[model samples]
Target: MKITFTFILLNLCIFISAQNDSINDKVISYDDKIILRLNLDTNVDDYVISSKELNIKPRLELNNQINTSFGLDYKIISATVSFAPHFFPGNNNNLKGKSSFTSYNFRFFPKNIIQTLSYKNSKGYYISNTQDFVSNWQKGKDPYLTFPNLRIQSFGGSTSYIFNKDFSLKAIYYQKEWQKKSSGSFIPSLNYEYLIFSDNQNSVKSREHQLNLSFDAGYYYNYVITKHINIAPFAFAGLGKKWSSYKSDVTKDEREKQNYFTQNFGAGIHLGYNSERLFFGSKFNYSGNHYDDNGSNILQNNFYVLLFFGYRLDPPSKVKKVYEKFQDKIPVL
Candidate 1:
């Protein structure tokens, strides 16, 4: 099933690439250069449960970890691999238990359209508000409630279109292009994901599967301060639907299915500097979503800061030859 889904998604992206239009002259293209980037970002996940009837709110979070990723961009395709290294200071906190995260992401830009696909896996989590549960819990000395066997895996993809030809999202994201002048765009996107949540606790195992779909309307503006510097800000809001199926080893009811409505919103800003061959950037973003789960409100929130430095190099002859060979068959290349 996974293989079939991936194949279909790839074909869909390829079909979308065929509909691409020409970019405006204000956007500088760097299709001939190969860009290598190093990125550092806080990759943390958090969940909050609130119950009005019980008059209590509890929060759960994964260990706060700094993730490092290596990215490569050549022509229309870009890819990144990310992992949480153990050598990072806060990643090894004993109070939060052990946690791990890994992700693989790819983006394809075909003129004015952008398509993205990603897979992420995370394990281990802990209740963050230990003092609320334990009256005498000492800070930094007491352990929080830990879910060492909890795991989450997701497969996701998104497709977006740039309505304004003068604006280049690639300038702010992948650095494959540069916007010569200030411009804004009303970009719209469709996102979909399949997620699995599983845990084994106290000898009882449970699992849940969810499929989600959302549509977002976003606006981004790139303000060119100078020839080598720019600032970009973006905001988006979306509504989604989630279909979930859950099962437990202790339940005789086999599987239970449920549907939920969700809403999400976020805003962010990026500051960047770009030269002939070197580029660096920093970004800060916050996002949150909420849904009703069995009469209780469940909310997920995320905030992260990212820093990246990248350098452009000339592609080798063999690499250029391979890309040229396939450019005719795959228009996205």
Candidate 2:
């Protein structure tokens, strides 16, 4: 009977050991983590992933390819709107919406670089820039401003590089198509700046300019309010000269004044708020008297309710959200 009891005990021990081993072997490995992600018809690329530390032995540094086995398990759909007024101090009406899905699988680890590419096509009633460009209602004579039918088709990419978590340089390149536009080509650009404010250690100030082919020196700051909301406020003022020369028929009887000392000296500020998911954004661009109505000297204010949307087949990484829940434990240096 003692031998029988001993035999039963031995069997029980083996059974328990086997069960534990199986559990370990079957559990998902963090090294097999998905680093890249994509959602159906979504604007922002959410591939901004970080080390999945909670899961044990993150597979951040692996040579595995992206895995697509999960197949459309979840999704997100939403909409948004805004109001920005005539070049400044007031309000303008705006609105928007979309539907999308997200999925992932892989073991790819990258440190501080992220890129997002997307495309979105939306149709709505907008101020006419496709037709008449200059019209403004004034107190007496019309306010001598041009607002054309603004049917714009824009395509662009937003990219970011973090020299470190504290210092990141980001920029956007866009080519727009307006049914009927203005003097400037379809080139509209924005930079995503993340810099240390009041740190005084960076020693790098923000720079900006309207003049082409000339170098101007400047300061910038950026913040992410939430997963889908981001705000970047920057101030820059600089000096430069116009590189392009225009011929004057009135001055020299059609002689071109091709070379002259053209200086643009002014101070300006930029306010940008973006909703990554919906690809919605607002910008307040104000500069101190540097541009004119028709090429004459006059103080001007150029403002817009920047409406843009695009879909990204791939997503980008944003470390802020990924680390938010763990912020208490992280050193904020």
Candidate 3:
């Protein structure tokens, strides 16, 4: 199923590319749309009091272009992530699992606000060794299924705006609700990002979609390192309420109700080769606290990473000199 879906998506993207029209005018116009690629990310960090080491998952991304307009564009982007980790503050060396996704970017602005109205999604899957808040010591085989179904997510759509190529604010005030069904391990009550980095090239391309600002609001930013290797790092802080399944034996207080209240922040980096017809490269991002429940809100403290190879449907322009053969061609009457 994965192989066939990939093939069909790829072919559709190629067909879009051939139909793209030129955009020499100030208002960028386009048609060619279809892109796909693979990504990987790995980390070796020690967290908690004793030492919590981890090895996260990899990502598979797909973006199929549909159309374009001034400060407005349309494309669908989907990603999948799977990870395995080991915690050891208690010295328990067991592995865990996780995954999620996002789709479509419907906005664009090269020199302006770069506002976006796109559909966003997220989800995570996990399984633990022994059920406990604190980690257990003593390295052993994978204990990743004891507390399986630690979390599950299903949410979509919301409007967003960028301040510049590197910064902006967003709101998904009318986004649908979804949450995880885990014990001590939960999200929204604990929200988080895959990674954060600079993407001046807007490589992720989720800046356009269908929606409005009704419920959730957020802030984001980007930074560029080099023209050829642009970095666009962003951060998000939001507020909303959803349904979450906490510990059954815990207090039934409304404060602990599975409502939506989040303060998440992370950014991503885009390192691609740009031209008149193509912008192909890799991306990555990170955050300090997984769900911010750890209590540290400093933007420059913790971080994560993602690395992928991406290509745009329309290739950028390449500087080429006028050759003798083409230059000598006779003019038509």
TM-score of each: 0.95, 0.30, 0.39
- Preferred candidate (lDDT higher): 2 or 3: 3
> What does candidate 2's lDDT look like per residue over 1-333, in tens digits?
243234434433333232111112211212112121221211121111122333221111111112111111111111222112123211122211111122222111123332332222221222212123333533333322211211112222222233323322221111010111111111112221111111011342222112122223334344544444445554444443332233322333343333223223323322323222223344444443243223343332323223333322222245434544454453220
Which runs of model 1 end up more than 4 angstroms from their true locations? 1-21, 328-332
User: For model 3, what is the alpha-carbon lDDT of residue 9?
Assistant: 42
lDDT of each: 0.87, 0.25, 0.28
Q: Write the per-residue lDDT of candidate 1 for residues 1-333, one digit (tens) a residue.
A: 375367548746565657445656898888789999999999577889998687667888778569999999987778999999978998889988988899999987766788888999999999888788889898799998899999999888888988898899999998988999999999998888888999999989999999887888999999999999999999999999988989999874789999999998889999999988999999999888889988899899989999999999999999999998998786555
TM-score of structure candidate 3:
0.39
**lDDT string, candidate 3, 265-321, tens digits:** 544444444343444445455543222223332122234354444444542333112
Best by TM-score: 1
Model 3 spans with C-alpha error above 4 angstroms: 1-30, 41-137, 142-145, 149-151, 163-227, 243-260, 287-304, 312-333
Residue ranges of candidate 2 with Cα displaced over 4 Å = 1-212, 243-278, 288-301, 314-333
Task: Point to the candidate with the largest lDDT.
Answer: 1
Q: Regarding TM-score, does 1 or 3 come out ahead?
A: 1
Supply candidate 3's per-residue lDDT for 141. Answer: 49
